[model samples]
Target: MGSIDPPPIKLPSIKLDTTLAELYKRASPKTAGLRLGLASCGVTSAVDLTPDFQRNSRYPYQDQALIKVPRRQLTLDNTNLRKSIAKKYLSLIPQRDAFIAGAMPVILFNLGQSPKQIEHDRREAETTISVLDCAQRPDLIFCPGPIKIPLQPEQDHGHGIDKLDYKVVLDGLEANQDRLTRDLETHWFLNSKAALARSGLPTPRSEILETEGVPPEDPESCCRVCAAAASSSSSPGSAAELPLFPAKCTGPRGRWLAAQKDRILSAARARPVPFVFKTQQAFGGAGTWLVRTAEQKSALLAELAGDDSDNDDDDGVLGKLLAQVTSSNAHLGPATVLLSELVGADGDGKTVVGDYGLTFVVTDRDDEADGGAAHFLAASEQNTDGSNAWIGSTISYPRQEQLRRKFEGLMRQTAAWLARYGYIGPVGVDVLEVKKSGSGQGETEFFIVDLNARISGSMSLPLLRGHFVGRGLTCASSVSIVAKGGRAGFIQRWRKPFEEGRMLILSWYEDPEAGESIAEVVIGGENEERLQELVQRVRENIEEVTL
Candidate 1:
């Protein structure tokens, strides 16, 4: 929130390619093209493109194909899926398509259920990605946001839509759509949170409270209506009413919150252990803190009540934090505080992190799940530190059956919840398994961490291998190739194991400068030793080849 300069405006540069020229010749010289924003955060771009293509069966148009032009550079450590996408584009899209000049075919298909009708009335077609030339106005341009800059006035030389005729799609529509989507997701999370509580799952106890004016000073005044409704539902569970977690909705006010924080701090200190505090609106562990001592809690409250001089810009965020804390019994502390119960480590002295679990997705074709092939992608995983652990390094594959069983149940529930909320894309539910405290029996306790609502890291694993398991591809044979190389020199490495039909090579690269390259090779074969060997060889090769 500090004083920072606004980013400079950028102008678009058209890169004319041969394929685009050919596309211009084939389509009516007067025909217009449609360009959809396929950026990562955009709606249409979130759908899994490969399955969409297989399901739809028809390439919409030979000359007009969907493309994903990333606004970034590619690195040597690209994933196998990305490499495959690049190769596919190089082979499919011709070099002479006129209307599609400079566009990269990162994806060949556009998949998303469209509204019943699209209006084509506007004279100036608008998009987030600027189309430099003003003469060729597309009949309909679909982008995720509103246009910020005006197009240059010019006349078309008989190439497309009449000069000075284009339409603009406002950003308000897309923004509203995204907001609705987030609301729906929040509702789903709420329902799932209730289900976990009812099913005797281990989750942090919480409640929802709605209030008028600023939040009340007394926590007892907060309503428990949402919790009551959830508990009374006719789901399969014990008939006894369960204790509801506190959830509160409130307006903006500093005085009410200052009083409430004092009471919450006293109540929290009365307990044996310190409590964890979080802001309602914050995501990804932001605005969360652990309060362990009265001194620290008092300091936090002082900061909240202190005058705003240097941190005036953070006042809005601080206001939201105060509202959330006072609404319920949650407190606010220093960002560096850590007061949660310490979960024990594994036998090997390593803290056991949660499984980076992902949902196995099998899309329904004709409303039936039978014919659709399942593809697995890794989703976000919850680590011991309450942060998201992605695919490559943070988490290792869960090798124990006990851990896997607990994770599988969590995943099943997660997938069901996602399906209910109209999300057909690849999803994942990350959960952690820690040893139960004071049990002495070494029983593992499971906790639900976070939900990933999109295609995750594991999605590419299965695809890289010939067989798609809906989570990851098995590359046992490919792993063997690396394993064999470990016994020999790095220069004599064999690529044949990865070439095996069963193995999936996630990535492969050879750098000239450092002479070092890395690849994510998955082992799919049944042989454990062979897989181990392949992993060793790959590791060794990476070390030797890299400068």
Candidate 2:
């Protein structure tokens, strides 16, 4: 096992850390001589959802080359920045999404872009227990064959989680009519950032820039971003004709944001340095942006308002797209938006402390009298980029007592809050140890930034590291890795760690045609500094897999 180590930021790769995003996956961590699974999902039926399961992304940034370019040198060219970011973004939809194959034992996924790649991933999952020697999860069910999705034109097939085809989902439900899904409604408010601003919690200060209007008994069902998470048809906020929001902006948040348009437009004009402009629902960092400069604010607002007059060329277009990812169409209506205060960052606005993802399990007995429980599974420090898009997660807290002391209370309160709403499942919260901007720089504050209602991108970090918990290995970190060969080489390269029970390969997606693969891995180490040598060794091993 590996101890949590310094991040591989200097390596030739792109990362945001799962500032890491949300992907609802059920995770079971070892507890008191027993194994308890939260959100116990069984795959009684499989959705040969293989064909149409591509992810829905608004920007045209799906080129891997773009991601390899140094951040400082990156420009908006048709080169390739979008590809890695887009993949990272897709890996983080709010619900059970792109990389659930990693967290859950019973894998349901769309492996890369092609059917051939899907076959590779399917093989990996099928042979996981045998190859890796890890215990098979209780809720294990291997779907039949690697269903080959026939190639089709872009318009004919539906994308992955964000814009899945309702027809496809319902159609695949031919046999397993009884779906085992959680009650997202009960906990939506407590976890959503848009709602967090209104909730009375020990959280960072925030105000709604946009939100849903005429609440639908349950606001989550009507929220454009949340509603639109599963598919365009997931909510009425999404028009049936086109995958767009309603034309008129009627939400009060819209009115509030518009009224403050002048303030927002000139927010960074002078500059004490502004903060984040987050669209209510987004994966990866697509929905999050930092308004640090006037030029950035202009480009952001221009992008949001659908005005290209100020957009220069492909270079300008790429920058605008990366800066603000919510489609103009979504913003055409009252989609949820927030103007969040910065926390956990240095005075100059750089995030020195980085972000942390807190994962908790909320459980309840039907007998209301039996009061429920929320267990703190683990916490991972998120690795992100200048834009704040999350790359991966790491868990290397040597100060065990202090780690639990600081976050447990908040997680307990959060769980209690969710239980009150009669919700049960797993929840992930993103928080930061705030470094006060002004005179109070010495005094730090812990503030909640985002509460993920579903299994988060980094929720698997703890589970993956548990294999080495008893060992002397003191830390662990998860990173999305790209390699020359495919999963075979990945497995071969890290087989020793797998056999040694010191590492885990949670997710693997290989594109054979492209002769490349992307995977999410957890590396164990003695401590952060000592773990660097190990992290680099594996990184190089994985990167040069083909050879």
Candidate 3:
């Protein structure tokens, strides 16, 4: 959080674009029906969630572990071990299911896990949901977890570990596809539509897949399928004319890494040193590196070049890079990196990053256009600790509607672009408005840095706001804190604040047998300042009580 001066210029209010209102109308729950939710953190975020790579590193799960257990007992207790193995992976069940209301019940699904593991994770997720008073919020059931079918010895490859998991889930889905489609809307939502498509499910829209340079459709096989379909006149559009995909509009990647690297070098020569390097494979800033000098960039590149030679299971930036390569294609040189003009401080400037995201649902598909359309659901302001680790999020109307309009336009363009590939589901876009030169007086610039085509940490803030505000609250924000030792019960000490409408424990899960707990609080206040003040008060109270 750097300090920034107020707007250097008077910003004009953006005239409301009918796109949002139209989208809202189209997505009314009356139009949207009950759809099954495929709730898994890793696979949805494009990260491979397997025991080999380990549980999801995203929050709710990232901090979940058995803190005080004896090492020897950990190996003996299969139940506790399964819970520990799948703790973080199960966090999304409640998080995603919270968005569903009405009679629409979701059948939660997960891959690379057993039925016992899924049940354990579901129980853990339900504990937090109960704390949030969301136990009865949505009608939900846990689908039997996917069975792991190991790859044969001859065909075993590093990639088969993930591929096999998808196969098991997809096979189960196909076996019961008739029953599922009959009983539920069966909307397949996960991180990678390409992966989903690989499971024999339909592919969804995703620019990440596009910029990764995966051809929109498999020219050899998929085109043949489309061609045969066209011969039968089964679907719309011609085989010769594929939809014109919009060029990569935002994020760090364009074309191949080789070309992207050349652009980075060019940008470095023109601007300042110490640029930002982000790996295409990382989620939650794990694959991000700060290249401080030419020497550092050279060293980092040298390390990346040796990625193929390294067998070390490191989870740092390099480890994440290698993991992404092994999970993706082998021909991609074992790693890919994106270099961008560092969005850090600008020449002795002091600035605070105004991080924001828009969550929307794709509503319509236009075969003529290269992409599809989406309806805006909510807006969220991300609160980071300045290290890219998300602290929490403030959900409110933007002070500058103009900036929001720009964000909406970008999202619409992105959604339409993704729609080209038949993707329709919840989509989140990450945008940043930086104070030019990192100073209050510096010129301001906003860049769309990342595109999360799946559910994200801040995605649920808007939903929480809708849920709470509808219950007669002024505003709402989601705050998370690690509950260490006595602080897991710190909520009892903050009873006065909860009674005063300063804070509400939306979801609190403290393992009865573990030392570390996670408390996800939905704090309410009359205004943004009051909400922030209440959050601070809660933190101060926790410190005193824990001490």
Residues 304-394 of candidate 1: C-alpha lDDT, one tens digit per residue: 3332224432222233334332222222121111123323322322244345454455232222222222223333232223321121322
Error of 1 at 135 (Å): 32
Select the stronger candidate by lDDT from 1 and 2: 2
- Once fitted onto the true fold, the runs of candidate 1 whose alpha carbons sit more than 4 angstroms away are 1-39, 42-201, 206-274, 290-318, 322-406, 418-423, 437-442, 455-547
TM-score for predicted model 3 compared with the true structure: 0.56
RMSD of each: 19.6, 12.2, 16.4
lDDT against the true structure, each candidate: 0.31, 0.44, 0.41
Q: Which ten residues in a row have the lowest lDDT in candidate 2?
A: 40-49
Q: Which residues of candidate 2, in runs, are more than 4 Å off?
A: 1-51, 54-107, 110-121, 129-135, 138-181, 184-191, 211-272, 306-334, 344-355, 365-372, 435-444, 464-466, 491-499, 537-547
TM-score of each: 0.39, 0.60, 0.56
Best by lDDT: 2
lDDT of 3 by residue, 1-547 (tens): 9998533222111111222212323543343333332323322222223333322222111111111122122222235544433333444323433333222333344323667566655664454444333333444445433222122344323222211101101222333444332211122222222322233221211222222333233212434443343354324322211111112212122123334334433443443455665544333434445667777666555444333233322112332333222222333332344444445535434254676766777655433232336656666776655345455567764333454455656667666665655545566666666666635565655555555554555555554444445435565676666566533245456656554544554433445457765555667666777777877876664421100
- Between candidates 1 and 3, which one is better according to lDDT? 3
